[model samples]
Target: MRLYNRDWTRREIEERVGRIDQIGGIQRVRGAEGVEDGVELVRIRTGAGLSFDVIPSRGLDIGMSEFGGVPVGWLAPGGVAHPAYYDAQGEEWLRTAAGGLLMTCGLMNVGNPSEDGGISYGLHGRVHHLPARHVGVEGSWDGDEYEMAVKGTVDETSIFGDHLRLTREIRSRLGENVIRIRDKVENVGYTRAAHMLLYHFNFGFPLMDEHTKIDFPEATLSPREADMQVDGYDSWQSPEKGYDERVYYHRNIRSEDRASVRIRNDRFPAPSGAALPISVELSWDAATLPNLIQWKMPGQGTHVLGLEPANCVVEGRAAERERGTLVFLEPGESRHYELELKVNPGVTAP
Candidate 1:
């Protein structure tokens, strides 16, 4: 069988079908008129049955993801909130959390509210609420494979406070159910600055039901709160009427250079009745992101499982500093973080 393109030149046609490969593509679109006004979105489709939306105005966060027409991520009912509506107080950030596949936390602070050295820091920091500057999206064919990416910069600064910059790139390849995120946080001020970052990957609904199970490397699991229940840390429960959220810290001792985790729902089938078992996998460098957090909330209308990898915990910057685990970047210094999310199909439990 042969394919012909009437719109392409001879050379272009040859390049198009040179390797029998599928090329992924990206498109820029305006937010829905009444749903997400004043927001810009980039819709990406990898020929491998993976698709997602990226909000360039919201720190380039992934707004939603799907595999074979089935949503793999959760979204807040409030939709995307503009930066002008962001509240730095506790719990107020949730009003505009978006709750997508990826919600980047931190550039200055993260976690619960706290007062450190007389400065009050709010919950989960302010990076996600900040708009990205110099946003650009592009797609290209790399050798026999096609790749697409969106790049941008987010600045978290003040007149006399910390001045940090985050340059982020979200990339995906054709015929691959994977999304890769690369970030570089630089201290642009004249003094050392405390930095915290967390990649909050949230899954919801059919992908995160009671039958869903989380698998991670052998690690020490510590409850965020002493009174928190630990009945089934690796498995989820049905959504309750008034269930309280639970947080656990996974301190993985990697036997290799990299650490990985997976959330699989073997009982969930593809929307097309295909034998594609649904699963999401996260892989990252253990040295860069030394901490992992599992946020389980099985509450009605708020069901989600967050697999967060971070440089610090969610105990606020003050607590992290007190524990000497708060990461700091010196003037003119920078740090890089790499994370990958892969969607697996046709995989069954052992």
Candidate 2:
């Protein structure tokens, strides 16, 4: 039975393979006792229960996500940190912010930390602690369905400066709970490259407490603090212990061309109740992510909620190049980003 060198005759080494039923697959974990201990995860089990954790070093974000067993995201207790402890400056990347489910902030810069011509950006960029080259994992069997993915390529170079390149792809199926992300940000170098991206998506504790609810489409919630107080942007709060985090900026109302957002938790009773309520959807493409940030942290163990999808406007990178809305990338040009994360269990809410 020759496998790697090719030739295998004897009726092809007594061929009789037949055991294809895999509903899901892709496992290549390491350290931290099962998935985080110096980080290097890739555990994606779809089978139907839906699982996640693909931190190819780091830039391949997405740290935690589960379905039937609960906990749809949010991890940051400093859980998955290895990227050699990344810390470009200012807030120290929230001390290895692993508040995941998907956190791929930017390619060059995104949100708060200013300084431009003199260079000083920090606080959301660095492409989530960059690292991810090659890193692959693909599974197939489409006739009966059972697709799986996880590809990578992050590269935000800098010698003379800025050379960008990020080709990520994370898909899933096989009793799908859904999670498809495809990015491609090239500008392989020569000039023109400002590009900023965001896709934070974080939620915790039974999909966030206090009867979570947030379904926006006809937006315009702005309130990044101008004496902030939007009166419960979408309502949710219960983890108090010194809470103080609120940043909203949705501006949707596109009316068409794909753009959805939801985060319901009717009462959170899935498993035993046999799929009760529990929702989560964030489809995208309003002409390539048109900005929507809303990170309201309730506090306590830092309960999370940060469904951000952006292309710019977290106000850094010189205030997005003085509000011209900074988003360059042309020197070979390349930009494409599609995201979808649905996990509806017995859905509700028309």
Clashes of each: 1, 2
RMSD of each: 3.9, 17.8
What lDDT score goes with residue 334 in model 1? Answer: 98
For residues 1-350, what per-residue lDDT tens digits would candidate 1 score against the true structure?
A: 11221233335534666442343479898865654778888989886678999888889999988887788998888787776778888778888888989999998788888788777777888899888999999887566556789999999998989899999999987668889999999999999999999999899987888778888766788899999988788888788998889999988646467788888887775776654566788999888988889898889989988889888889898999989988999999999999999988767463
Which runs in model 2 stand beyond 4 Å of their true positions? 1-23, 26-48, 51-66, 69-103, 111-135, 138-149, 155-161, 165-199, 202-223, 230-266, 271-313, 320-350
Candidate 1 yields a Cα-based lDDT of 0.83
| Alpha-carbon runs more than 4 Å astray in model 1 | 1-24
lDDT of candidate 2?
0.79
lDDT to native, each model: 0.83, 0.79
Give per-residue CA lDDT, model 2, range 1-350, as digits (tens).
22223533334322433332333477778767522566788888775676888888888888888886677888988778777777888768888777778888878788787678888878888888887988888776555455778898999887988898999999887566788889899999998888888888888887788888888776677888799887887868788988788898887547567788898887886777653676788888877787788888888888888888887768788887887888898898998989888887768585
State which candidate has the highest TM-score: 1
Residue 39 in model 2: lDDT: 72
